[model samples]
Target: MRISLSTLGCPDWDLDTICTTAADNGFDGVDFRGYREEIDVTQHPQFTDRLVETMARLADAGLTVSGLSTSIRICFADKREENLAEARRYIPLAHELGVDTIRVFGVGDAEEHSLEELARVGGETVRDILALDGAADLRWLVETHDNWTSSADCRLLLDELPDDNTGILWDVGHTTRLGGESPAETLDAIGDRIEYVHVKDAVYAPDDENAKDDGWVFVLPGEGELPIDDALRELDDRGYDGWVVHEHEKRWQPYVADPEVAYPAFAEWYRTVLE
Candidate 1:
């Protein structure tokens, strides 16, 4: 039940400020966004060095690393090869940083590919990345995003991969938005394959015709209309202890002004509700 914040919410800030703010706010860890403007491919070659420094900085600030969110698509056709090659470059870096997982997104949309094809492509991509073994370090984590956000869909993809080192990184908000599935059902579908969890809240209006595209919006854990309490209760009942990354995605959803300001509020909410 350790709580963390993804730097995705604060893509405009530097790593130093991010670590400092996270530690100051009583957060346990920071999920670094590896492909933002402030944090991008230029440092890809020096990843080992950069990650070592990042680790030290967080340690000095009394913070841990929840994970790394690499903005690389693993399931897309045109970008899959280049993305895998790029991911191969970060495996050693992640290991050196003592990061256990790297977050990746699946490709295709509900409109583009059949569920069967998406599952096959997602599984194949995961198998390939898991085989990299760069420095025999790091595990690949497929996130509940885009096409694979459904609990049943992700379960299908997970069935195709080796469950030992590869698994699901469940994003609650995204799952609810895209899949329109209940938290209990989603958890039941993924079962033990959930290696990580992205915690956020959203409001859904199923009655609206634009509901699928525009109903959801980011908010603090307990602030939004989402059933976070029920979700957390289910997670607790199941003995789930994965990282709860407070992923208020300000990059795409800018309702929250700044992560520096928002993370502390969310941390307080987590402490009050989850503690």
Candidate 2:
């Protein structure tokens, strides 16, 4: 399996530095977060041009643009239309960048939708996204997060959609947290539809308040308490060849330290554990 690092770890770093860091660390690709505040997606009249430039820069650095990671909420009660309209913008951009998949979020209660309503809304939103996807030559991926963080729930919703242009971003830590499902079972639920994986550790102190369901506090690949070995074994057993991006999401935490210092150590630890 190819391993990559999420650009989110270095949100304060420029794109060039992000790519250079990933390349220098012997990572195969860089999972670019184009929707971060640092990037001005609306500056260019032509989003495709921006995409080309972005991909070209990565190519120059000898790195592949693993995927376009975006923080998109698919289900909103009052703003659903506006959200979808803006989201359709990423499809063509992904296509132009020669990147096949774009990351998106599942429906959540933050949108004022009830749990049941969120599922219904989630299904409908996926249908709409897939409809728009037919012309983009790109795939739409919903991460294991928010309301659909449960693997069973996500699997059910994904079953409702056409797999031709839709799949799952199997975020192990997120799903494990929200689903209350075992990692093996979660992997079995998603099965072949997992387009990518976000590798992070969920750890907690015994006395910490957030110590529930595998604990809390997202950490680097190995520092936390996640059963990452078992998860990777399951992925291997399933023949999953997609990118497994190290998602050091809480890199800003003083305990976690800078990604530059944490990531290489994390990667080395990951390699050692996997081996």
Cα RMSD (Å) per model?
Answer: 3.1, 3.3
Return the top candidate by lDDT.
1
Candidates' C-alpha lDDT: 0.73, 0.71
The segments of candidate 1 whose C-alpha lies over 4 angstroms from its true place after superposition are 39-51, 109-112, 135-137, 204-212
Task: Report model 2's TM-score to 2 decimal places.
Answer: 0.84
- Which prediction has the highest TM-score against the true structure? 1
lDDT of 2 by residue, 1-275 (tens): 88888766776666677777877777888876643454424334324446566677788888876887765676555557765776676666666666787787776674564556665666677667666754346777888886778877787668655678778998888766656777788877776788898887767665665454544765656677777777888888778888888877643443555778867876786578768
Runs of candidate 2 with Cα error greater than 4 angstroms are 34-53, 110-116, 133-136, 206-215, 250-255
Q: List model 1 lDDT by residue over 122-231, tens digit each.
A: 67776777667662356678898877888877877777766776788988777776678778988888867888888777666556443346565555667778777777
